[model samples]
Target: MQKSITNQNQENIKGIIFMVSAVLILPFSDSIAKWLSSSYTTIQIAWLRFLIQAIILIILSFSLKYKITGFHKKFILVSIYISSSIVFLFWGLKYLPLANNIALFFIEPLVLTLLSVLILKEKLQKNHIIAVIIGLIGTLIIIRPNWSAYGMASIFPIVSAIFYALYLITLRQVSTKTNSKSLQFYIGVISTILLSVIIVVCELLNIDSFGFKQIDFNDWWLILLLGVITTIVQLLVSKAFFYSKASSLASFQYLEIISASILGWLIFKHIPDMLTIIGAIIVISSGLYLISHERKNSKT
Candidate 1:
């Protein structure tokens, strides 16, 4: 019993480390994407991100002898859902401050909680309902709908959150049956293909799609860093889940908001207003409470 408890503690520690590292690195990729969005279209950026990730995944699969199995229709849907979320996030990043974007995107957890209740028929715990309401109120505070300052771009993150929630729900369904490497590779391939088609259609239509921009040597490095960091962070997050329960690791994700805020201030001279800061605090508190509530329920 003592040995089992020690092992679990070790796993939790490792999971915390992995999750913290991933969250810290994630903001850098978002900052890069926001910077690149200035020069490239969202579709173009999404395509490159997935293309690079797919290439690396393919190489890793071969070297590691990871089998590429599972070619279900749900794989395609997951790819599209995730791809759409990325595109919307990049689009919003163009106009929104990084902190604001992160805060709004934080609604994803709440959305996921709601979906679990609705789709999975999980018990609608009272604490969860309260958490969801608090989270939405925090989101509204950041968005400040009365002011209408962010305009249509404000809607992008909300849309992204919805798609992201759907992605998580779908991921839950497919994850049990598929190997993680195989699942990621399939999603990457499908996303790359879908984005490539969008790019081609934009080119053919001669539309004002944020069509591909010329990549200078300097810009090439930034784009490469974006893809590599994203892939690494994702792997770390997966490893974290492997090491510990998802509920135990949930609170660490808010680190991204802090990291994003600091990065935004340093890189773009963007600071969250008083209201935005307050909203972020509220959102984080609600999320933490929800995680604690879930943990307690699991224990019982």
Candidate 2:
């Protein structure tokens, strides 16, 4: 049992690393999609992204011998989660700056904490409350809310975050009985099917046109990279929750903000202003403390 616990910890650590790396890669993918967003509709970009993800997920599931069936009851909730996530995220990418969009996503952990306390009856530790406060302070720094600077684009990601939190809470409830890979696979598959239906209906109704911009061959590499890397990342994140509490792993998501700010500045020549930087630090620090606290409590 001791050895088993140690092994699980090691796996969780690896999952954390993969998840953080994936979070780092995500901003770049968003940048790419956002660049394409001007010419392409939101559903077009979403379908393309999910189609690629679905293909990669199928291959991985088969190769790893992960079952993709069962868990019928969880499908509706999972579908709602992924569909809402894809649409809102793509739409947010369309209108908001990359850094701003990502910073708002940080709220997801706080949302998860609230859900756990309310729905799951999980008590928040002292550190959990402190972390949340610190994280919120960090968010305020990033948004620096002013009467003059608000826009509808900012609200989309917040809605996305809320939907994502609900998704996480539902996953936490179901994860103990079902396999993590299966959960990830079902999400990808469901999202793919839903997207396909939406694409066909849109085509029929002439609601919007999908522009298949003949790619420059080289860009196809990035698209493939985006698909494969994201699939692997999703699998790793799913597995992470197997060993750690969803609420525990959820807080570490704040690390993505630091990664996004650095990447956004380095690749896009976009720098977060002083307030954003201060907020990022507060969120990151509090989130780290929350994770550590959870780990310590779990051991005791």
Best by lDDT: 1
Model 1 lDDT, residue 115, Cα: 76
TM-score of predicted model 2? 0.85
Candidate 2: Cα lDDT at 218: 61
**Model 1: per-residue Cα lDDT over 1-300, one tens digit each:** 767766676766676688778988988999999999888898888889888888888999899887778688898998999899999999999989897887778777677767766775656656656766776677668656632778888789879978977876677667666666777778788999998888878787887665566677778898888889877876776666566544444445655776788899999999778997887787678657755654554344
Residue range 154-211, candidate 2, lDDT tens digits: 7778888898888877776777767766677677777778877877877777776542
- TM-score of each candidate? 0.83, 0.85
